[model samples]
Target chain A: MNKRKSKNVFINGAISSEFIGQSIAKHQSKTTIGAHNIFLGQVRADEIDGKKVSAIEYTAHEDMASIKFHEIREETFSKFDLTCMHIYHSLGSVKAGEICLFVFVSSPRRKEVFSALEYVVEEIKAKIPVFGKEIFEDESHQWKVNS
Target chain B: MILHIKYFGLLAEVTGCNEETLEFSKNSVSDVLSILFEKYPDLKEKDFQVAQNNEIVSKEMVISEGEIALLPPFSGG
Candidate 1:
């Protein structure tokens, strides 16, 4: 296993945007890639039938989440011909409108990069065991677990 | 047998503790859940996912003399 792949797995309450960008740059160096695409997921503050969501507190069953993430990483590599990929998610609290996730993928061409990015996002949403606590501006909250 | 069950997220709110040990007959995950529901009737309506020893486990997983069980809702990506 390469250092790039093994170290891409992270579980933290917060991550630096520059670090993510650097990681992508590092991965892109080896590939004589024509294109790179990145997706950044930000939390949105919205009204839920009258209650306004102000922030989100993300949590996870860490033990299970780590294992699930490792599995997804392997599956993504098999599904895409991408040079490399990196996935990072925020744990603990993230305010509304703050970026919560960053998915970066690079391939030899643009077409594969787009597809791989989408696949990684979808797989993370469907399979990862991270939960979100939608905090209303008024301080009320609700738990959101991806189905 | 007495088994320690840990609670996370909303389950922690309902149980008011991170973990507790309850005595039960040698039973499966489902059986232990039923026992929990009987004691805390409020949890009957809440959806729960069980894990045994830090791994996501099915209801069919058997409980022996000493094991850790967790009742947490699906909170993933």
Candidate 2:
């Protein structure tokens, strides 16, 4: 299949469960998809120096990030038998326990979705130019780096 | 040549501004870094990668008039 056109994947704040549900609902009409997998990244209220994290503020090099995301989508499509895929990441603030990143992948079989989902998530973590500032309850902040 | 520079994440915090433009007589990425380091000495202590025209390039890469971004470690999931 030809690669899909690049679309902006950024959302202004935390992704709502309602939006995720609606996204899944929209895919019900695509009968060729037999399995779907999803990955949701939530902010953690980690304690640092006796201070608890209250939220995470995300920022990105938007032009570069959009290009990287598009490249990942193209590579994933070429490497896997995917029927469709979607990626959404939050900008601005997301409180602890709120979803910040959502990745959904669908395929005609269960196996393809499983591996494809992992690949897409890993690529996003490693390649995208999105940064997160972990904000503590005391208003202090630190930069978060992927492990 | 005038080059547009952008700072991201911790680097932006250190630089105090998200983006700026500077004139450089030299043509390589390292030359730009030296000029930036002179202006923001603290940037030397931070970890980042250089991207030219939206793609990560090494310090040795020659650059022209375009966008240059200093990106710290990515934390997106």
Candidate 3:
């Protein structure tokens, strides 16, 4: 509610390092922010019963997901002293070791960003309605259940 | 009444499609599920949550007008 753009957070493919870099660079002008914390989620190639995970395909109820993201943003801003916050998640196939989720939180001090980042990430895991299908190298797939 | 149902993740695979509009006179969430189960038997075996108007609803909640989503366990980061 605090002037956040309430933008769509889904990215089409893997989050490129260049894109991540540009996001960080954009914050340079905000001299009020003295600290920033980031959390990146990478797909892991796990061998399950001899089949290795090749990639993860993500899907979501877009309308509901957007609403949830906006709620999280508002709650975060209200709960912490954050100057700015941004979140992005991949939508399509992202190979193992590729980045699928990115969360960045900035504040005038280090302590707020640290706790705010964890709270935001955990809320997304428990509340957001995004799903992932883990595709094996041989083409078999299984649903990913977060722990 | 007519209801719009949206499916996400494994629920979509179980339902064999992502979204559909079904005509029903259901009074509660469970009644709606019974109809869905008859159409897609696999849906009964999958674990998921039901959301109505962007908020997760319990099975006892009365069916309401607006978009509804069948969400599988969240795997988002």
Candidate 4:
């Protein structure tokens, strides 16, 4: 609603759908954009070797995670020209096949929307401080962090 | 001085806790690792990267008060 508060990022324990919806509505957007692209990253149960990944226990050094997210948010905004953007990522434990990160990008034009959305998602994946622990179906586990 | 360190990933399992306060002088990240590896001999090989207050730091990075010393491996996607 305020000029200075349209773009924001929520890096938290677990992102709720309501929070995602609210972040979008903050723009009070009336552009009537021809396209709006959204990407939701959900955890999927998979088998590694003979081990099945039943769930992911997500954790982060909270202070650092928040700082990282904030920096990424500011960078994405400066790089992309869009009507609005919002990013939310899960912290603590997120089960297998559950949503862990949600990114939404909207613009008046479809072409810019696609490119901006992709860039934001990629940057978040590459730079954010989130960590994952893959829980095997048999209850064994291992941590999953990006290289 | 006592340094309260936090462990993530394989390091946490090896240490048996997410955090521990240890005795050490005011030193760089490398110094902390030298002490920790001596205490938990098994941790030397896993090869953790050090972070002070969430940013990627080098071995010579100095740590001060109220900072979370992290031993995390690269695990981002």
Query: Residue by residue across A1-147, what tens digits does model 4's lDDT show?
Result: 224343334354456678777866765665565567788877777778899887777766667666776776666667766766667667666667667788877777888878888888777776655568888988898777554
TM-score of each: 0.84, 0.98, 0.97, 0.81
Residue pairs clashing in model 1 are A129-B75, A129-B76, A130-B75, A130-B76, A130-B77, A131-B75
Interface RMSD of each: 2.5, 0.5, 0.7, 2.5
DockQ of each: 0.53, 0.92, 0.88, 0.47
For residues A49-137, could you state the per-residue lDDT of candidate 1 as single tens digits? Answer: 79988877887666666776777777778887887777788888887776788888877888888888888888878666666888888
TM-score of every candidate's chain A = 0.85, 0.98, 0.98, 0.78
> Could you tell me the TM-score of chain B in model 3?
0.95
Tell me which residue pairs clash in candidate 4.
A43-A97, A145-B75, A145-B76, A146-B75, A146-B76
Candidate 2 accuracy as lDDT:
0.94
CAPRI verdict (incorrect, acceptable, medium, high) for model 2: high
State the lDDT at B24 in candidate 2. 94
Off by over 4 Å in 1: A1-16, A145-147, B64-77
lDDT of 3 at A106: 98
Rank all candidate structures by their lDDT, best first, as comma-separated numbers.
Answer: 2, 3, 1, 4
Residue A143 C-alpha lDDT in model 4: 78
Count of clashes in candidate 1 = 6
Which 10-residue span in candidate 4 chain A carries the lowest summed lDDT?
A1-10
State the lDDT at A137 in candidate 3.
Answer: 95
lDDT of 2 by residue, B1-77 (tens): 99999999999889999999889999899999999999999999988999998999999999978899999999996
Model 1 chain A, poorest ten-residue lDDT window?
A2-11
